[model samples]
Target: MTGIFQANRALLFFLTLAVLIALSSVVVVDENEQVVIERLGQPVRVINRFNPTGASGAGVVLKLPFIEQAVHLGRGLKGYSAGAQKVRSADGQDLLVDTDVTYRIIDPVRLVARLGSTAKLDAELASALPAMLGARLGPLSAAAIALPGNGGAAQLLRGDLDARARDLGVQVIDLRIGRVMPGETALQMTYEIMQARHLREVDAISAEQIASARQTRAQVAAQAAAILQDSAGKDPEFYDFFRAMRSYTYVFENPDAKNPPTIVIPPNSSYLRHFNGQ
Candidate 1:
């Protein structure tokens, strides 16, 4: 009975030791993660979602128990918005600029060597990006930066930033200027200038329309005069009679006038002869 008890105790001890070793030696990496194995604080290898064979490294990975340490990092695109920063425009105008960047770690080994950790990387970017933007944008006018789309300063900064970020093992997918707000004084001045320009345009359009209307009125009056002259040439007596009748109607149609106008006229007057049957 004592020998059987000793054998069972030894088996339990060995089983416990084996389980501890297995747990320490195994590393599990997810599909969206990259792991860096370091031996004695020195980087040994990088196991990521994509290997040289194009296979995912998403299962139990073997490492030396108690010797190798694994550091996991997310393998996904990261976005950083560097909120409003004060910058000077080329025209010597002070403005606030907001910016954003999208990037991904292309080489984890290089990233670990240079930046050490994601927090450190973020700090570096926060310091570096605004300085870069200010330097590049400082030579441009407020109007240029405030215009829509990627401005000239932003484009230049994007190229320069991408080049600089390459050293940190990151690929800058996009860099953009989100907003540009001018100072209060500049904003008021710009508004006034725009208003003045719009007023000038409106005045010009009104002047053109008035000139066109005057020309059309002159043309219509000339046409009416020519038609009247043609009718007079065809029959002078009838035209004279029609003229006398029109004058009589104008002088008599006034609501305040009596049956005949108060003005006196000779009985043989050509205007009054229209009322005579002959």
Candidate 2:
């Protein structure tokens, strides 16, 4: 009975050990995840939804407990903002460009073998992406990159980067240019040029307004002269009387005149007839 009890205890211990090892060996890869199994620091297999090894699409992979490791990477698209970088344009203008890249790990085995970790991959990209961007953008003028509706330069940049990044086991989905700004000197020059253009526009508008005002003044003067001529033609005597009255009012009521001119006229003159109630 004692020997049988000892044997049963030994069996229980082995079972517990086996259970621990089994639990450690089993890897559950979710639908959105891809796992790279490495044996002794070398990648052996990648299990993902595309390469489903189980019924539920949640890949259940197994590896040796102490000799293998599972590296889980997201199969979903990942975004990395490369941040702002200084690049020179073809027209010799320095531009500060903010950019981002969207990519996915296309070949997990190659990615594991090359970069080893996402952090290392990111580091590699951070260095290589900007260089690639600069290379593509170097041939583009500042206006080409800074223009609002033009996307050809950016598309070219994405194409070049995608081609280059594929070697790193990443498939570039999209590349975006968030902001493109000129350097300090270039910005100031642009502002000055814009200001000069606005000033010229304002001057042209002002000149046009002045010419319009002169034309309106000439038209009004011609109209007034025509009306006066028509009135004079209608009644010559009344026109003379009105002119005399206007001259009299101007001479007497001229506030700015320092001295009044004395006019000698005969007592029976027509100019004095109205004042004399004749």
For candidate 2, lDDT tens digit of each residue in 216-254?
999999998898799999998777787889889887876
lDDT of 1 by residue, 145-256 (tens): 8887536677778787788888988778888898888877778999999999999999999999999999999999999889779989998877888788777678778867
Clashing pairs in 2: none
Output the TM-score of candidate 1. Answer: 0.59
Displacement of the residue 102 alpha carbon in candidate 1, Å? 0.7
lDDT of each: 0.82, 0.81
| Residue-pair clash count for candidate 1 | 0
Candidate 1 regions exceeding 4 Å error are 1-15, 49-55, 183-278
In candidate 1, residue 214 scores what lDDT? 100
